[model samples]
Target chain A: MLAWAIPTYTPAYPGYGASPALMLNVSVYVMLFMAILSLIRISVAVYTNRPVCSEEREFPEDLEGDDGFTQVGRMNLLHLARVMIPCVLLVVAIEYIGYALASFAFLMILQYLIGSRKWLQSTILSSVLVAVLYIVMRYGFGVPVPGPQVF
Target chain B: MEMIFAGLLDSISPASLMFLLVGVAVGVLIGAIPGINGPMAIALFIPITYYMTPLTAIGFLVGLNKGAFFGGAVSAVLLRTPGTPEAAATSWDGYPLTQQGKGEKALRMALYSSVAGDIISTFVLILIAAPLAAVALFMGPSEIFALISLALTVIAGIGTTSICRGLIAAGFGIAAGLIGTEPVTALPRMTFDVYQLGSGLSLIPVAIGLLAFSEILLQLERFTVKGDSEHSANVFSSKLEDRLVSFKEFFSKLKTLLRGSLIGIGVGAMPGLGAPVASFMSYDQAMKRSKNKNEFGKGSLEGIAASESANSSVVASSLIPLFVLGIPGNLAAAMLMGAFMIHGMQPGPLLFKENAQLMYGIYGSLVLASLFLLLIGRFGLRLFCKAVDIPAMVLYPIVIFTCIMGAYLGKSSMFDVGVMLTFGFIGYFMRKFDYSYVAFLIGFILAPEWERALQQVVIISENNTFMFFQRPVAMVLMAVTFFVIGRTFWVSINDSRRKKAEQAMSAEQAKNG
Candidate 1:
């Protein structure tokens, strides 16, 4: 009686078996379910609400988000490019310096980029922090911390 | 009592004090940074603490965890961007104050609240836990399970949103916990034979991806969006003295503070739920109980105070279950347990007998840590204020990089690092679409435990589904569960209607105007 019958198998790729659904009550209940539910609720609201059709209506200019909560401007193309290039390069270079070295360099640079004028203060604090971590890792945990080679 | 005095004396030593102060400072900084969190900070420090005496190491990590809770507020107040998920509630009201040229005052309130609440709760934790643990020594798994159920019930009551969504979130959390090797059976649930999946997803990477990397992606859309600080961010003279509210006005709000504290402790003591829930629940309660509900989200100091104190107090409350029952209240406490274990101290019933002095040391250290939090957060306010100045152009990449680095630290594997970044990008999309990143975090952190618990239940129940309903405690918990779900759905429905009405009224008014 059914003209359009569905196939049972979607077929699996090599090294795979009959694929279970992407959700198996396992993935659905943990976190993805909440997201799905919220998305549905919010989306229905957004879709059903009609535009007011008022020219003066706009997002409040004074609204804030917190790291400091003041309104932050969008980055110019140049500024965005400036950060993106170095970020990509840093990913490639991250392994060569070892974790501690990479952290020290990265944090110092970040402090500057964030407009910290207390270079000496940051350097001293960073040095102390790294030193404390170094001692802890080497002596406390006995991990052979990768110090810069003497050679 | 003898051991307690000795432990206090030991912790008061110069070495211990140094470790405690440094730990709190380190905790705040690590917690303040986007993506990094309390648990990961503790884990990272655990290895480094091996050489130190357990007193120093434990002292330091405890102080550090406490410190991180407050640190996130600095980033939350200035940027309107919470540095940690716990600070998200703080941002709702805290950020509004910043826009009103009251950033300094807002930050000060958060600082004082975090310190005061944390100190008060530590004393409460000490007084309550010792006696409770002693009493609970005779308890069996049946009682433990019941307690956990009650705790979860309390936690489930936190969110004011749709009850279905909250239950769905908790169910998802339970299901997420039900993965990997079954503890009772040692059989894999759905590992697919992968080595990494065998251990399951770690909380640190998940938090970094969800809170930090995801935020970076969201911010990327408006990477160039900049707003000047309020016309007078430097308008310091009158408000500098905290003249916005009279002293008589401040004393009158004590009732709200106490009520929020009660809600915070109740939500916090329950496992799985953590600071964010406590803060939000407290904030919600404050609004409901207030003579002026609209004052919330409108630069109300009481709103800020309630949320901030509730979150910080939850930190101490979280330790109650940890110290008494050996069940961690949340991810951060779980990692702290791991650190304690690595130090040759298993924190459970035996822990009280074998290491009573050490227990007292922890109690003493928590008090000291809260004191330091108050001292540092107040005096260091000006330094933290500068955080408000960082441009999104520079800050976003740094946050993203920190997340990547944090993920790499987890396994020292570039593979895991890539996994962190992948999740970060996905997490970004999740946030844009109003996804429950908190659910994801709960899932990742509790996956192994949830798996173990379900397997235990399945085996104990002999696959008899009715067993879950058979126990009186479980029955009560289930009843409460249903009530919560029904209430939440009802509220959400009402909320949607109310919002619709407001929008229609606004539209009509606009047309007339």
Candidate 2:
């Protein structure tokens, strides 16, 4: 079962100018084509008695149970939070504290979050890593490392 | 000839040599480590190249690319875990050899074959890319547009398990690619009044996000969901005979080596088929042709040669399209394209004419890199084996820091850092959904050129959408796109129906039992 359809895309700002958005229109057209193709794929999957694009095997016995799925989902979310929260904080730190101090703190925090329970060990390692990186990036390579804003 | 000599001289300069050596070492270390590969390393290091000379930077990256291929086989041989997908077939015979205490023999054969393949294919690149670029220079905009369309169709249809997902990923890429402004009119289209986005998203941020950051997230999830299963990389033999291959023994497999290189070049030149495919194909051919086929999975030197040679050769042959037509044949090549553009040189026919010296310099560096691979792989094998033992907990966090630094260095804008984070999440979801990120990236890389060619076609055709009929090449390419897409859909539908029938039959048989 195959089908083709074009979805109308209203521009975010319609009154920008008199010039046509030829590129955007073509992009939208391609996206619409993709949408139609996806719809067909979903429909065929359902009709064929397959799960909707599920990567799971057919045999229930071979599959991870609902509980397993929930546990995996929970673990993934936990892992993501562990990584992303520290990442966001690190970026915020870099904004206020400059590259050297921010990088040292960020690496220490990240190493801890990734399961380094030894604070002194992680701090020493992080400091050395940061110093090396700062020297290479700032002095050796001449790329501008971010400095704290005075304001 | 003088240009070639000058290029060779430049490649052999102290600074270039230093960077290339470092690139290869880092590449090998990364490739030997599980859950990291060449593309990630290249993406992370690209921003650092902002300060280096063009020849040095590119030579460094090329060395990285070459070293990673051989490095991947190290883990495959010693640990039974392929560090890169391209080395998946290597693990088959390599692990068996390890079990038989011939791991050193397997490693040496892999190194020799890899260098041989890389050197041969590098020569092939020198022989072909210029003439092909000259031919590509004559292509009209309409034909170019049609060719890009055909390339995208093939990549979307063949690159992923699901054609719909691949095409949708490409569509999303095109949408993202159109975010900044319309090229012809210079009118902002999807910027939503974010002045920072008046210029399109930077390549470094997006690439770092997609290739490096997302991979980190995936690795984190992998660790969380399934605890890391660490493999020890211990060679089973210390015998001199087992550690070294004689010249006569290496030369005995010349047929297998040459055949693998040829298969690699053929497959690697295509847009979607990549090193993994070439390696597996070469391995299968070697197995089929060998008189002692039964020995293949039980530690055959020919198997290692076939797999390693083909995968390593792909590093250079995959550059053929990128150098000749400005179309990257794979993800690594695409990243290289981004690097080229970052260095203020566009790849294509103009590169051959305008940067002939640079081109020859790059070729010289590639050959040099192969020799470096041989030297490094021979001497530093144990060091790289130890690299595989680096804990994920230590590695992932450090990778994140580098990614952040890489993103920030692109434009010195914290905004690009935000962009990188956003794309990181997008890349995570894209991977979860089995979309072809390769297709997405290629689409993104080619989007500007595609739009320009399309605009030219429109103006040349006077708004006639069917103007393809006037250009035979364009018409044929378009037809091929349609035909391939149609065939892919047809095959997919038939496969689904067959699976459904088989499932029903199996259920019936189970019920009867």
Please report the candidate that would top DockQ against the real structure. 2
> Number of backbone collisions per candidate, in order?
36, 0
lDDT of 1 by residue, B1-513 (tens): 799899899889899999999998877776665445676566445544655788888889888888888878866776666767788878787777877777777777787778767877887888898887887676544445545544443444333233444445445445444444445434454555556756555544555555555555545544334432321243233554552444555566677667767777887787767888888988888888888888788778788778888888888898888888776777667667656765777565657788999888878888888888888776776665564455444455445555554555545455555555656655554443333455445444444433434445655666676766666765675576567546656776677677767878998999999
Instruction: Name the 10 consecutive residues with the lowest summed lDDT in model 2 chain A.
Output: A1-10
Best by lDDT: 2
* Model 2 segments more than 4 A misplaced: A1-20, A44-50, A53-72, A149-151
The residue-by-residue lDDT of candidate 1 on A89-110, one tens digit each, is 4555555766466656755665
For each candidate, what's the DockQ? 0.11, 0.33
Q: What does the interface RMSD come to for each candidate?
A: 9.3, 5.2
Q: Is the docking of candidate 1 incorrect, acceptable, medium or high quality?
A: incorrect
Residue B113's C-alpha lDDT in candidate 2?
97
- Computed on alpha carbons, the lDDT of every model, listed in order, comes to 0.62, 0.81
Docking class for candidate 2: acceptable
For candidate 2, give the lDDT of residue B260: 96
